[model samples]
Target: MRHAHKRCEDDGNWFVHPVTNKAWSNYTTCVDKDDLNFRHKINKLYISGYSVSVIALTISLAIFCYFRSLKCTRITIHKNLFISFIINNVLWIVWYTTVIRYPAVLFSNKPACQILHVLVHYFLLSNYMWMFCEGLYLHTLLVRAFVAEDKTMKWFYILGWGCPTVVIITYASVRSSYPEETILTPDSHQTRKAVRATLILIPLLGLHYIIIPFRPEPGSPEEVVYEPISAAAASFQGLCVSLLFCYFNGEVVALLKKKWNQVFTSWKN
Candidate 1:
């Protein structure tokens, strides 16, 4: 497919191939020949469902945040989970509506695209980091129930704000080594490597789950009872697992199917 901003003429109004010096008409055909009907229907379904979910989650978080009394309870770790959920949903909404819809802008405008790209990556990393923190906090409460009530506010701030910042800084540092000309090509092997790395890194959530449950605590009535930490750990673990299934595994399978179909069609033609 031709680039959206392909230079045409020296005067800069025409579509010209830089390599071939071939001038093309201003009017270009759509890259995908599929009818807009199915695409539009899919887009509507995605936007409506995602928007509703994000709104509901955000409202729930706001209500919880406003009630400071509720935040003091052992169950407040769930509030952290709620906050993480809201942030992630917001990221998804922005990603789909802005970034995904403007692929050309992302590729053509380097500075703006890089900023958006970094922000997107930062939040995506933050979502998982916060989930890992949630699991850690939950496990701590389960094993050390009394301590869960002590210094809850301090730990809450640390986990919610501190961890994401650290992760973002680390990512930015690593990304800084690469040149600005690093464009992701369609057949890039680095894509697979990055995916593999992410998958390996995300499972570190389970380590938090394991560590929290190992902390020492006195055997008391509160200790015997299921703590909020355990619940949060379980909830976050379940979420991580489900997301892996739906987002990674399912999406990969669908992508493979689409690629295979395209290959078969090309061979037939």
Candidate 2:
């Protein structure tokens, strides 16, 4: 996909599109059959990645919910983060399967599609916000030896869910005033065994956004490497987070093992 921009005039007005005769911030670039096929493949990878993430997140969520012993401030925060990711992934899956897959649905510019567009971004923002809450909570715990869990949790709830609502409302209100524009937009190593795990997992967790602004020019040699890396980072982020925080967690692993052994011994008896 290409990113085309309209330059603002010196008088603070905007440049208009020649075809639509309306002020536009961005416009889509036309692509050939080869590019279109490439995009289809990328989008399929996205669907598959997101589907796997959703399944992993759902199972993680269930594990956290089922084990009453796992209840704590940290696990509570993890639950909310998992929830945000779950909703975000489900919405994205819907979007790719419906809006992106069907040119008619995308171009028809219906109200439902527009609503879906807003919902997708809203949850996307929530994903980051909840992540921020996670970091904040960790910092607070480390810095303040006796931090109040209830109070911190209240703020976390507001930041994780409420802040995104405010942002999306402002964005939607402003965007509603404009004409609809078409959608267009726009990794690395490890030590031996440890290095290989880091290389594979870091992108999956979407940590590659640290260099988002450094995107190479379209069709450049760098883009050849950038595209698939970016796609994997964005698509598999939820799965990676769940694996690290849930499935790979020592406490969670211990609880699951104990429960499994209990059930097995009971059945044997």
All models: lDDT?
0.53, 0.81
User: What's the TM-score of each model vs. the native?
Assistant: 0.51, 0.79
Instruction: Score residue 120 of candidate 2 by CA lDDT.
Output: 95
| Model 2: per-residue Cα lDDT over 1-269, one tens digit each | 66677889899989875555779776446446676787788888889889999999999999999999989877898899999999999999999999899877876778899899999999999988888777676555444555678767999999999999999999988888885664000011112433433444445444679867898887678876787777788888888889988898778999999999999999999
Off by over 4 Å in 2: 1-31, 181-206
Candidate 1 residue-wise lDDT at 3:
41
Q: Pick the candidate with the highest lDDT.
A: 2
| Residue-level lDDT tens digits of model 1 in 122-181 | 655565655555555544543443453456657766766677778777776777677444
Quote the lDDT for 235 in model 1. Answer: 34
